[model samples]
Target: MDPNEPIESADSTPESTTNKPQVPPIPTDGTPKKKYVRAVGPNLKKLLYVVFALLALLGANSGYLASIIAMQWYTGETFENFFYFCMFLGHVALGLLLIVPFIVFGVIHMRNAAGRRNRRAVNVGYALFAVSVAVLISGLLLVRAGGFDLKAPTVRSTVYWIHVACPLVAGWLYWLHRLAGPRIKWKVGISYGTVVGATIVGMV
Candidate 1:
């Protein structure tokens, strides 16, 4: 090659020099990523089941109360005296009424707890119901053994007043129990309803 010849003669050939076409680099840093959505958990399902169970129980209990009132009306019984005796029997029977709803709810929801650990709410509620039943039975037996007539003229008799007052207290406590709830109002309301229902049965 001539000395003055353009240097392009040596490197101007594209294929002989190994020069490569430029390509943009893929982005790896500072890219906005998509968020993954999580699924709902089981505890929430259990809570929902419990709430539903409570609502069902409440309806059942309200019906039971209405029935007692209706029966009294039908019989033309003295509300102040004979009604108390009838309430005594009715409340004891109420205990028996509660078992079905609770069992149905447990099976429907697949709740396996048995009044243990945090399930104390259910356990305590059930226990109170049982106690109420027992109290009703015993009180009735006491009245029967004493040979005291429920239809006696006086409404303020000692035994009569105690029956009314004791039941009234129990009913109020059960209502408070039903109303007690934390962040989950429905859960608490339903769970607590059983207590009130059982108490009503005991008192009635």
Candidate 2:
């Protein structure tokens, strides 16, 4: 060591120089350690997975339905009757496949909301979900009224409008809820990346 250099003490550390509290060690004489034994609250991971899955399904349905609508609007349904029929069938099939899971997730969401400290977000989410469900039920009745027919003007005009609007509004509310909730870690981003990659590969 250079003579001009100040001698460093073994007791001193760079970390020790900072202003920090020295937490007192709790007594260990058979005392109840409530802090250590306390429950870590509800695990929200499954809820998040269910939510994102629903969002993905909603997005895919929106894409397919919007494309079909665009084809009809721009091309005047000049596409073959079989093509339109197939598209309608596909949309219904997707909806049917997703509805059960959607309802399940909604129930899970309500349960989670009950325990949520932030009731505002929970209430908003639930309200949006209810609106979405109402729109879906109305749309289903419209379908049944028309004998599973999309050719009817009422089904195309009125039911279609509600079907489009409700999901969009509900999705926006869900996005807001996500933003207001507790922040997730890098794992979520990684999982999303993997899912997207898998979806693209599957599509191709």
Candidate 3:
């Protein structure tokens, strides 16, 4: 009615009457930042699950070995027995302990990848770990079955040396698993776990 006068705006002409900054639309490319894939590939998923399970089992076993060795070391009189047993068990058990976590982590890494790169070192690590466990267990079982007569000429220091060495090598290989990630940091974690395992086994 008052075209000659300045028109006073209604209480609400439009809520968005003023110009607003427009947000850029998201790109159609499906790639999302830090988007984790479901990792549904049957084979890769199975591998990841199996690897995780093995890590858990191995960790428990290492704990058992460590306990036995520590107990044996506590009861025994001769430091020589303690030393030998501790060294062997500590190395083995600790090595396993160190490795289990990394292996589990590696499985996670693999599954998350939406694709797996070179896993050769990691695979080698698993094999070596299994072999180490078997060797140590067999050696100890042999000694125990023979009435703890590890002092026999046939079961010489060389046998003991091998017992210690098997797991040590495995430990080192497991350490390589850390390299599976971007960089390699050879801190004392796996090495220490191996020592603990060897210590425990030795006591037993």
Candidate 4:
């Protein structure tokens, strides 16, 4: 209150004047802070289920053709018909429709599993994916070599065996993959039913 004794301004007090606890500046380097998102959304999971179901159908058809029909009756007409069937079922239909989505979503799922430290799932998923890719490539090679009408007998035989073998391996890996992940009982049932039905239809 003494005029000669200068009163401290309210704002000049240490508490009032103290700088706010500075927020640490976000790092400007290109490395972004890791952010975890939901690995598979509900919609994506459903789509993956559909993809898996179609894969089951294709697997059944191919398995039936190779094991029961092709091995038993390797006739020219049968081979030609099977080749056309594959072209329609595999190359034209499911391959064109679902292959990209399957690969993309499968990789994403695997990466998410890896991030979540689900090592077994990641490993099995990767193995399944690799085998599936091998099967696809070998099938293409087999077709290119004239399917059952093999022009290059050696190459066709080798590719034929590889195409056949990879799927059998993939079937096992697929089951393992299913075991490792959460089970959708209904989807599994439907897939199995589809496989059985497709196999029966293939027989006819």
lDDT values of the candidates? 0.51, 0.64, 0.56, 0.70
TM-score of 2: 0.57
Looking at model 4, residue 126 earns an lDDT score of: 87
Clashes of 2: 0
lDDT of 4 by residue, 112-150 (tens): 667767678668888998988887667655554334545
lDDT digits (tens) for residues 75-191 of candidate 3: 874334555565456545544454555455445544455344456754665565566555556555445443565667665666766764665676677667556644644354466
Per-residue lDDT tens digits of candidate 2, residues 1-204? 789998879877776656688789979897875442111124445654655675665465456556556777887855436645665666566666666766776776676466656778778878877986976675675565444766778656777678778877876786676666667465876776677656534442
The lDDT of model 3 is: 0.56
**lDDT-best of 1 and 2:** 2
Q: List the residue pairs that clash in candidate 2.
A: none
TM-score of model 3 (CA atoms): 0.34
Identify the leading candidate in terms of TM-score.
Answer: 4
In model 3, what lDDT does residue 87 have?
48
The residue pairs found clashing in candidate 4 are none
Model 4 misplacement above 4 A: 1-36, 67-71, 74-92, 145-150, 184-191, 194-203
Arrange candidates by lDDT, highest first: which order?
4, 2, 3, 1
